[model samples]
Target: MCVHGSNNNPDIGQLLEGLPTNWGKWGPDDEVGALNYLQAEQVLRGIAAVRQGRTFTLQIPIGHEKGEPLFPGRRPSMRMNVLDKGHYLAGKAHFDGNVEFSDDVIFMHVQGSTQYDALGHVWYDDKLWNGYDAMSTIGSMARASIVPIAERGVAGRAVLVDMARHRGKAVLDKGETFTHHDLLAAARAQGTAIEPRDILIIRTGWIGSFYEREAAEFYSDFVEPGLTFSRELVEWFHAMEIPNLVTDTMGNEVTVDPRSGVMIPLHAALMRNLGVAFAEVAQLDALAEDCARDGQWQFLYTAAPLKIVGGTGAPVNPLVIK
Candidate 1:
């Protein structure tokens, strides 16, 4: 079924009633959510895990000609040249210093590329993370915007749970789902364990497939195959103290819940309630392949999102150093 056409979905508020929450766990004014778990100690731990000194940047190019993978309504970034050789040749521009440079402006969402979502990105029942009022997001994300996340930054040990590789497929089928148990199994198979507060990066090979297929074929029947929400899965994340969730998919989880027909309950169940930070649309193909080859699944993960004030989210290119 299509993501938007969920047949008789349950009330998200009622559907998520009584799920565990981290509201006020830090303080009444807290904003960065579980990323607060990444302190100096976590940074040191990340450094310790870096043995090979290999660095991989995990972001897709912003302005791909074939078009970037995006959610249904969002459009790809468009870059327009304001100053370039053409302008200079047209005699519309001249430099006294004989220096010419190209300048362009990009028009796109703050979440247009690999991005880190603010705690207030989504909510229900008139509240965001840390019990902030839902109305605080009016006009801009007046509260719990991505600024705090960008300010603090994220650096820590991360485990790559290559779900697509674990399942012996180049890409998981559309709408395929996995849970905490599956994550554990995949980690075991990869010869690693997901430690507490670790940045959890999962690969479905979904984003990698975009380069190999047409945008129409990719967006067709676009129920992204990914983690399915469950009480046990939520509890596992809380128990593990996971600081961030990174994935190659757009929504980061199965686009629509099959049983409840709810679209991305994890956005509410984990992010809104439990304050788990989300990094979506990451490019993880090369990293996953190397991890599989070397069996080095744990690495140093670092990301610094642009400090866009009042932004609901901001573009980021996370680094994985092994």
Candidate 2:
């Protein structure tokens, strides 16, 4: 079966109904969906949270040099170094006293590592964000490209809802999931409030497991512990007007949906339909540690995807400052 094709599940259409959506809410030419909520005031709020000069790099290094990517289709990046070998270094000297250095040529899958999914990354039916035809819209550089995200960058107050810490466990076991209530409870426990335009980062302890076990073992079975996808949770995010989100899981949502014949349903709903970007595979363990130690979960979060024009996604090195 084609992964991108519409599901045969009869209730799919009904499931989408009544959920909040921002289609045309900004304008007919709206490219970034809920991201428009992160305005000057929101940025200022994030900046004000930086009480300490400490910074946390939220990205997993690109490619297998660090660790293997869990996604099968996404390959690790390749790098080729070109060393300095000029005529001045040889017997046939040309320059008087100049020397050269080395550079590298890198080939990478944009979403292969810690990365942001562009607004044009996913779609349902024949449509994309703001009801544009998927084929024509994604075929060109007209709308929903990564360039806009790169140019603007994401700067806002980020709230880390550590699910593992809330449940008093190292990680949620396979097949375990958390609900919207659990998220709120976790935020409350952390003394952080989910606010409008806030960048939400949900920690599932999946990355912690990756660190504890063999890289191959962690990447072996693709199971992931993540938020339970429901109308309530998705709609709550909409009502909250969250601009963007990050998660340590391979996919922001659960690795596999409990419902049969559906995969990453929230990905389609949020990115394709809602026009929200997602930064996945974030290195959140250190940030979570620091938050728990300091009793502060709010921080200045910034992420900028590579400026690959008309790309579907690009690797990102997000930062959290406190």
Candidate 3:
């Protein structure tokens, strides 16, 4: 639980067990990490690939009853809406032209559903991405909030690494781990090449389990089929310079690590150390099916997190166009 300042020399290699990081690579004041690689040319390349005007929404329903929250202390969203008739009559005001109007308010955890993790979401050795102070920089008046991500607007060429399809399964078994080797194998099988600044979307088929089992059974064990935070994967991500990674599973990586015995190491390593963002709980089944039908795996993907200042994360509705 050691906290280091921006200029302090923290033993990150020892902490991550020889895994190097990109801290200070962008700059001392840099909040946007690997995302800086997303250039105008990349966006143009993504748009140029759109032969068909088909679009897919990669976000789950905000209040999906079947898909419950997997993380503890994160509850389902609650929405309360008042009908136009009840509201208009209650307000004692006559509508001018449109007599009916409805209003609703929602309250829920940002990470409870399909969401984007801000750069300030994770920290290692008491420091955040680019050596930003974790403690003092994530509150009411802090740096590296969701504003930068919102301002940048994640739109680029996205490649889907369909793990379930590669394994020939509807859904991966619980506790199964997809490693770096598997990622490359999946890409090779799909005839796709990993590119720099590409938005990587992984479909584990874990969300199918949520629909198959009861809510209690689905969320009880906290076990899932997801990527493994292996040193090989970290090295590959660094080498490829991927901007963001999204997965259908709640946690991007398997919760129980058999190798290092560390939990959520990918979160700390990617977000905290390398400043790579993550979009969790993505709904990729529809997109995967469409890609399979068209034999086109690459698409133009865009996501914009809520512009909540000082917010750690925000629910997102990502759009993929082909």
lDDT of each: 0.91, 0.77, 0.80
Angstrom error at residue 52, model 3 = 1.4
TM-score, per-candidate, Cα-based: 0.97, 0.89, 0.90
Q: What are the clashing pairs of model 2? A: 52-322
Between prediction 1 and prediction 3, which has the larger lDDT? 1
Pick by lDDT: 1 or 2, better one: 1
Q: State the lDDT of candidate 3 residue by residue for 151-241, as single tens digits.
A: 7889899999999999999888878898878988899898887777788999988875677777776767666788877677888888888
lDDT of 1 by residue, 243-302 (tens): 999999999999988878888899998899889999999999999989988989999999
Badly placed stretches (over 4 Å) of model 3 are: 1-17, 89-98
What clash count does candidate 1 reach? 0
Task: Find the candidate with the highest lDDT and give its number.
Answer: 1
**TM-score quality measure for candidate 3:** 0.90
Top of the candidates by TM-score:
1
Instruction: List residue ranges in candidate 2 displaced over 4 A.
Output: 1-12, 63-66, 84-96, 137-141
Model 1 TM-score, all chains together: 0.97
Model 2 deviation from native, Cα RMSD in Å: 2.9
**TM-score between model 2 and native:** 0.89
Which pairs of residues clash in candidate 3, taking residues 3 or more apart in a chain or in different chains? 3-126
Q: In what order do the candidates fall by lDDT, top score first?
A: 1, 3, 2
Model 1 ranges with Cα > 4 A deviation: 1-7
